[model samples]
Target: MNSVLIIDDDRSVRSLLRSILQKKGFKTRECADGTSGLEETVGYRPDIVLLDLLLPDMHGLEVLDKLQKAPVTRAIPVIVLTGSTDQENRLSALRSGAVDYIEKPFVAEEVTLRVTTQLRIHDLIKSLQTAVQGLEDDLKAAGTIQRALVPSEVPAGIEDEIRWIYLPSSSVGGDIFDIIPLNDHSYLVYVLDVSGHGVNAALISVMVHRFIEDFRSSRPGDREPFSLKEFMRSLDRNFQFERFETYMTATCVIADLQKGEIEVSNAGNPFPLLLERKYTQRLDRDNNGAIGFGMVKGSTSVHKISEETRLFLFTDGIVDVRTCEGTRLGEKTIADLAESTRHMELDDAFSKYQALLGESLPGAQTSFEDDVTFVAIQF
Candidate 1:
């Protein structure tokens, strides 16, 4: 049964309320003063509190304050009992955090009705909180599954250094990535970004991740030497963005360990950066729009590393970060940042880059502008 706590200094009032509440089938507790009432409130952890404004020891408002301060009793519903029906007393009680107000010399019907009303409200709030918590739990579980799909390290026997970062804009996000080792000499890495954030975008991102994961597991064209062009075309056809209103962009980079070459197929995303000892240059361009727009063959860009090379691949979130100086860190600025990192190892380089972006703008890391994701490969 739902519990009720009555706190009043008058013996007759407490007895009357207890009788009425017992007849209504509520479990009730009583205290005659504010100090004892507070102790009862904390001990009973009642669903609702009947708090009388006039008390002998401590002010009734002080009791309410104690209840609000304690974590255990703070959430209980409170109905303030007052001697006057004046607006001043009512406002004061409300401002002090009472859920409802009751005038003394109470009518039997009105008292029962008000108590039932507050109890109903309390039950409704608790139901909503439970539903919200369920949703949060589901999102956390889905996020864990998505992270598991994203490989933290490159697959075995792929002889190269690989590092990546994924910072979602919220508890769950729309950025997804993976590194699949094709053979001893070649491996595949991809970065994808949906146009928006939140549940719909996150769901779409999971779908995209699953599609790529299934394709990789099936060993796409292992025997026939799968073309990056064919792979992207397949993804485009499978997703068929014309049916859905949401748009997305993606880049798939194939890095060959033995040949020291990179091939890319992109859909309206940023170009990969080739970072060397002295300079940084963005690799080939794709004339096509985003993936859902029927982008076809030869949007591929090829780059062969001359000396020691570190390739930078990222979603627009990294570049789109707006700084405290009010400058939107765009593609050019990201390239410049990567260029400066040539002296550091790829892991240190990209981590420091993310750190700088966060420090450059207050609350940037904790409250992201978007889903910031990047993959760095050293060859």
Candidate 2:
């Protein structure tokens, strides 16, 4: 049952309103002055309030302001009751936070209808608030689990050689990467970027991460280097657009620790950059279509790693970011930045790269349009 607080100085007016509202299935409380009305509202926590404009101690507008200001009582709908026909006072009551107004000679039927309407509206707002809170809670939990999918520390045998940065535009995103040791001599390093953003994209990325982890565990630790091309084929065959309704871009690299040889593959993702002391090489000569379409065959090429080589792998979020003038930060610019920072510490290099990216875009941007993921390994 909904409750109503009636704040009227006249006993006769309060009696009439209480009798009329109670018959309409409303629980009612009454106060003869503004001070008592406020006190009762905080204690009773009514669904609505019927406030009379002329009170013994304080004006009705003052009471309305206090009701609206107090957090505990603010949500209760206030309907002003007035004996004046003055347009100014009625306007003042509304401006002071009254949800509605009732004239001095209010009819019983009008009173019931207005109160019922406000109650229904208030209930709907409360329902929406509850639903929004639930969704936020679910996203927070998913973000916690999705973040765990990334490598916390570089794979055991290859520590202090890998540096990375991962930033999701929201609580969860479609970008994921890791450097996993296949054995003491070979490691699997890759960055997978699913199309789109938010929860749907995030869910697909998590599934892909799980699939790769399962495949990793199935292989013998001392086995030959994992096949990047075959793994890409498996991924394409499994995550067809008809099944998951989305596609993804990926750059997978197999690094050989003992031979200093690295095999790199690309699938609709930015080509891996081989940054040398004086030259930068974009590894793949051709760019392939994204996975999940089952259209393009996966391809891989081998590169001889030199002592000063640094392998840079990243999602397109970096090169695709645009300035306010619609200038896209192309791959060439990233190559130049990586080449310039080759001799600096890994953390400093990445920091300078990010700072330059921000400076390129004029204005205050709190986030990117897509998830940004970058990983660099010193060979």
Best prediction by TM-score = 1
lDDT of each: 0.81, 0.86
- Per-residue error (Å), model 2, residue 149: 1.3
Model 1 accuracy (lDDT, Cα): 0.81
Show the colliding residue pairs in model 2. none
- Specify the poorest-scoring 10-residue window by lDDT in model 2: 357-366
| Model 1 alpha-carbon drift over 4 Å, by segment | 85-90, 220-222
lDDT by residue for model 1 over 1-379, one digit each (tens)?
Answer: 8789999999999999899888888899999999899888878788899998888998778888788888888789899888865667667778878899888888877778999998898889999999999999998887787677778667888767888878888877888888877766788888999878877788889899888767776775457564788778777777666656677788888887567788887776787788777677777566446777676553787778754888888888888888778787888877777877788877788788867666755752475768888888888
Write one digit per residue (lDDT tens) for candidate 2, span 116-201. Answer: 98888889999998999999999988988999889888766785378887878788999999888888788889899999989999
Q: Which RMSD values do the candidates have, in order? A: 2.3, 2.5
